[model samples]
Target: MNITVHRPGELSAVDRAAWTALQSRAHLHGSPGLANPFLSPEFTLAIGHERRGVRIAVAREDGEPAGFLPFQRSATGVGRAIGLGISDCQGLVHRPGFDWNARELLRACGLSLWEFDHLVSGQAPFEAHASATFASPVIDLDQGYDTYLRHLRERSPKFIKGTLAKERRLSRDHGAVRYVHDERDPAVLTTLMGWKSAQYRRTGRSDRFAHPWIVRLLRRLFHTRADSFAGVLSVLYAADVPIAAHFGLRSERIHTCWFPAYDPAFAKYSPGLIMHLGMAEGAAADGIAHIDLGRGQKVYKDSLKTRELMVSEGWVALRHPVAFGHRARRAPVRALRNTVQTRPELFEPADKLLKRMGRIRSRGGE
Candidate 1:
């Protein structure tokens, strides 16, 4: 395979078309995970516009396009998945049977190490380097929304009943409740980001929206419209006031849920859950076959997911001093985190401690 590196914006029309074609072929040939919008060229281009260091490695065989790997590189030669912290899916989008050495690819790109958290399945070459794998919860809508609802009811009747009851109560207490699946208003996007930022601080997590690049990227994506990639904003409202909203990326067949938050004032109503249900219904209607909730452990995901997909986390490294140092510095921390995340006994206490820390931090800020 012949590999060439280019900035995401430097890709020619031929390269972009080949990238899209490869993605589509992968999806049609049973790798539905490639249908995620995060893996699309448009997403890479969007990130390139908002942030520096975004590049794509286009591989060709016999002078024909073969594969594409989009990533962000730091000055020290450390590479990460494009939109590393935010992208839910990561992998090389290549034609079936296309194969290349990971180290060779890294060398060609001048990367000493490539780190990824949510590497999608079917990545055989990279799979060998994965230190751990996690189940990514997903809501399958292939059988339609009604079928999924029936399955959900069978699995957790009480959860469904309770959430619906809360919705009724919310409507009665506030004004009539309603949902908008694809909200286009930019102001509403700002409101969603505010809620998400506050929630992040309240839960002892870094506020993603605090970064100007991320904010600009999302705003740009909000207006992006394409057949294979688009940003979808779904909102749940009470009498014209937004209570809960979600901003996620979607392709023709897959909707990957990204950021979701609800007004704490309506916490009693479980507006986030209500908004998810609305998203499911709308996604199904829009011909989306799956709603990928992404890799993580959450009560809501457990309650709503129809099944889970496997995603790996690890780094592919070339035998270089930088790669060795990177692994040495990160391995111990990652091992401890994996242990805590996999064991409920440790995870619960750690979560409580984090919440306490968050409360203290919030108080300090006040």
Candidate 2:
């Protein structure tokens, strides 16, 4: 029942093999939050040249590699689950019957507060006392693309009908629609990142694409391949022109949707929505069961999701010297983040203003 935390890069060959095996046994894995190879020691070391402090947590059931957790602990003793905004899955990966105390793990990592946004569906520990959770919608395109469309019609008749009609309009006017899966084109991925960054600013959110390491990690994923952590880049083209693109990770049977971007010129076509539809069909064709769209309450996710799962997120305060000061200062910020969620409209004006200003600065045009 003893669990130990290790740096992700410190894992040996044997440890890596065991970790991957344990991951395979999970019912529905692949959040692309912290489980991807890009977050692994090999991948991280390859991409994270300057930032090498990310740690890997491994829980051993009597001296065997039972679980592994990947996270980055900051200077303030606060450990943030890696891929915070972008990753959907969070928390440690362990086999059944392995018990862990969240507090201990935080202590082992020399942290007071362990934070995660999409902390997986059933793995988080400290959330029982104070936490919030939500489901990410996913479309089931098992029987076939046509069958999925039928189910979508039955479940969300209006939404399915509208998107389909829009698809038709886009085809009739724009030209024939074409889908590319596992597209080897890095240019498509580059395009997606640009659009995603723009979308982030337009929606008044932090632009993750601005970070060099993160951007490098994604480009690496686009090139690397593994049965468990292969990149599945999807793109949609109209009249031979790229309109929408998404770069996600595929672990054999799970296609965890990640970065997505589309040309704003085709906003009426809703290429992003079309990209998801095409994604489901393509993923199902490749035998991928779950398209882990990650956690969020986006309208398009609701429109395409045929099922949902709830995941929780929160923080744990460490009992140390800096811990007290950290909590005292962070407490108000936590309250603010929670408040921002509850009273989104209150913050929307300010956020929008900031984003508008950024756009204005970038464009330098009226």
- Winner by TM-score: 1
Q: What TM-score quantifies how close candidate 1 is to the native fold? A: 0.97
RMSD of each predicted structure:
1.2, 3.3
Per-residue lDDT of candidate 2, residues 227-303 (tens digit): 77677789999998999999987775567777888999999988898888889888888876667776766778877
Q: After superposition, which runs of candidate 1 have C-alpha atoms over 4 Å from their true positions?
A: none
Error of 2 at 147 (Å): 4.1
Give me candidate 2's TM-score against the actual structure: 0.86
Please list the C-alpha lDDT of all candidates, in the order they appear.
0.92, 0.72
For candidate 1, the 10 contiguous residues with the lowest summed lDDT are: 21-30
**All candidates: TM-score:** 0.97, 0.86
